[model samples]
Target: MDKLTKGTWILNTTKHIVDVAQKSTELNYFETTALAGKTGVFLSKLVADKQEVITYEKVKKFARESSIDNNNRNVKMHLDLLKEYGKVDYNTKLTEVEVYCFSNEDAIETTADIYSNEIVDEDEDINIYSLEETYNVPRKREELVNKLVNNGYSEEKVNLAIKIQDTFGLIKVADNILYNEYTFTGNEAKMVKTISNISSSKKKDIEEVINRISNNQGLIENKITSDINPEIVKLMEGIGLIDGITVTSEIGEATFYTSPHIKGKGIKEKDFSLADDVFHKAKILLSCLRFGQEKSTYGRGKIDTRTKMLNIIRKLNRGEWLNPCTAVGQDYKLLEVDGVVRVRAFGNRFQMSLRQKEVGILVEKMILNNSIDTTDDMGDICSLEVQPSGIIIPEVRRQQMKPKEIGLVKELRDEMLTILRT
Candidate 1:
């Protein structure tokens, strides 16, 4: 890639990427993977006026480096998480996510409601495993495989993972990606049930439908177990699935799926695909988790995509790039439109929205804070300040509050109130 031209720097001299990077135990800063975490820790410190930097290149390089290098391994991952969430930050760790689920709003009959079946109701709170739950630890995977193998699992199935790990390393266990093959636990029954119910005239339709939609595997299996009729068995067998799909009748207590890779063992969603850019995007989203104001409907997926985007942005900046800025969440899009990036977390998304419009005011003020730049007059470059006149209380508020203090009566009736009151 061509190095970013010098012209970019002149665009915004106040941008400070070097300081955004965490001080390195090795040299200038911690690797890019650690940037998001550092950014998360210091997010509160950044002000609307201060320039926030997120390095795309060193971060991207660090991601690629961690994937390849075995030596810096200890420093590479957070001990508590024990897995790389592609490139997620500390906030993602704290943010709650949703389990894979389905919408139940359209169901006409309450009888159709199965307790354990995946269903999302409007505004109902649901819990989801974090990205860390979705990913496998590099060390733990090794230990699990060894324990499973020694316990007499078929060498074929156990070694399938072994072969995967040997060639692809950690990616294989986490994503089940191999040479044009993928694997997951307990997906066979659901794949079977869905296929067997196909009508004679709807074979193409059934298969086509199967090509789309990732059913929460556990849900389908739960449905199959509770209502297995003879017809369901025939339907199950025709789809190459055998009976033993275990699920409980327990209706709803909000249990989340533990497995991230399995959609059902035998069936894969052939209809869906993530573009290479999207895949990279997904990777970054997986790396950086959300810290604040992500709802259940958009929570998990948003965190995934955003993490992916930030990591890529951080990586791309490794070369000489312009005075680019990136912030934690969607709350910064308004500020972003003004040629500023908000890489720091700003509490919650709601608070983020509140401050976005004041970017120009904040940037100017931030420039003044550093007091680093000097003008031709030998004074601060942003010497001009807009000190706000104290706000006069509104008449409506004065009427509503009906101040208990006597000072309020004179101040409200005389010195204060909107000009309309006079």
Candidate 2:
């Protein structure tokens, strides 16, 4: 067979050559296959003539003779792959292309050399590149793959590398790449090392702490000692896991709470209260009552209505007496009677109340401790007084007030005021 036809026949028969080209050039399967067909045709001519070098013009001539696209554009595109894979040495400025013998041995050696020589410094900063830009550009893909592989990662790690790149950008990943030894600074590095050193059980414990903090929207870092493992706490501090959270260390110990600005999702400061434990219990009871034995709603597929009701409960449980003006509940209307606060869910009117004596004691303590302001004349009017029938709510005369003033009295209805005094 003639050289051109022989080349085409060899390309069709040998698939491994195309696979090598694909890996070396970081091209997709199809592009590398097409380029391999054209390359095989070109190689046949070089082998037959015993030539090591071909001018750019000769490349086009050979392409036409071999029934490959003869256009300079098509020939140049195919030649680019050969150069990238180190199969051929072609310079953009020079019009000559030097051919290397097509063999798997040569291909592997050359690509490995290229990778070793081009490996980036572990500390080098990588400019952020969007996934689209990296995928579309062959050069960028090769650069990433080479860097990752040369750093001791296998081909299987490519997806993981991409995910890291997407999350922290290439710069952070490069900084975090473990070389001969771990080289990083600050809390994040320390935390990573700490996590690596701990047992799997401890790791799970740490994760649980994070989940609890996340679920509670946040907690005082000090108050977090209850269920958390101490080793995990050390790791957390090392990693600055609670960075950007609200920190209040004055009240005996450092308190770390969630900040809406940082975590995107966390409990707002206003949503938390001393009665959080009680609110949580009440929420569980209500959810259980509403969902009953239904498996779906009780688990991962919980309804939004349940979530909203829990939030409302949290807000109401902030130890604030719900007068008519501020008694707005998203899915429920709140009622205070005899020192007990009741929540009636809007739909189905599902009702639940806090422990009556516990709530009354808390409210009384708050008033006596002056934690809640009772300085207004209205406060004097409703001041707590010891009576035979329990703490009695002082009366406000309707006739002594103007029309708008009467509305204020009406808002603080007898039942709500009675709860406050009691």
Candidate 3:
């Protein structure tokens, strides 16, 4: 099998790759995924600016602007990394480059909607579970196509839908079989029912809070009342519908809450053991993102630092620990003086983790307090099932969020917005 070269740093600077990958620092399990994230922001901007098929030189210029490893060689490596992750489409021949565009596409009813609604609205005798089973069970790609076609969808449209969903990482097609990764089961299915059962009297307020947290990643616990009634929050918590992870620092501590369905990566319901490491790693990544924005990493310039930071944060997956070198390269030492991050030696090399774990939740609170907008890339590790109307299981959606559903989350200022606010 051919070896992978994109996600790691090639130490042999003398050797250029897209050609060879000898003597590389592999990022397979050691948490260097942030480099691809950083590179994604660059690709987003490059596509936005060029607005057409880009050239090789444009990619190089953007790479040079990055604060993370801006060498000529690293540019090629970063592009390859993004390509592997579905962020860009570059021609290896180096003439025409097509990057994944970040612009929002108009909301049109999707093929899932078209087909699923056709069956249900028409009152077909087909057992819905049978239809769902057809989708959930891994089957030959040809079989699924024939099923969709037999159900009356044009073969061409069905093929296009499969292609689009595949590209969006919503499904996986391998060896002629289709696997839908967005299939909701276990706790995720339970969440759909929980959210659906919210009392109409409180639905307006509660769904607002739940939807906001689900969209913006999560919220600090004490801040929940600012958006909804305290009694409502208590009820939700009592029912195991919502929970939090508390992070501490020398100064204080704060608990961030969200439905278990939308909590950041690695955090699980009833899984307190992972919260410490998960939030701690989130803190380091958040701090490093802040540092990058302040230093104009990716050219954020004199814009709102919190918003800019969130933009890059949205591009990143919070669960992946930042590479120690990547952290230090972002000048994490400056943050250490402020007690934001901690650095220590491990074996022959150094390791970094967030000392001010409170900073992660605090920054999230700040963004809420200031009314900063979270971009489409809200950076939450989990995907919410956000279909407007459909059978919840077979047509479950992921990653995509509707604008009206994204409410502005608020922070508890002076602890005045406590759960007893009403």
Write down the RMSD of all candidates, one decimal each.
Answer: 27.6, 31.1, 19.0
Error of 2 at 328 (Å): 19
- The lDDT of model 1 is 0.24
TM-scores across all candidates? 0.19, 0.21, 0.28
Candidate 1: where is the Cα deviation over 4 Å?
1-179, 182-206, 210-275, 278-343, 347-422
Query: Which of the predicted structures, 2 or 3, would earn the higher TM-score when compared with the native?
Result: 3
Compared to the true structure, candidate 3 yields what TM-score? Answer: 0.28
Question: Highest lDDT, which number?
Answer: 3
lDDT of 3 by residue, 301-415 (tens): 2223455555433322242333333234223443333323445654444444443333454444434433446344322121111111111111111222111211222121111
Output the number of the TM-score-best candidate: 3
The CA lDDT at 294 in model 1 is: 22
- Enumerate residue pairs that collide in model 3: none
TM-score of 2: 0.21
Local error of candidate 1 at residue 386 (angstroms):
39
Distance (Å) between predicted and true CA of 254, model 3?
Answer: 1.7
Write candidate 2's Cα lDDT for 3-80 as tens digits: 222232223212222223335433231242334444544444332112256567765665564345777777776666
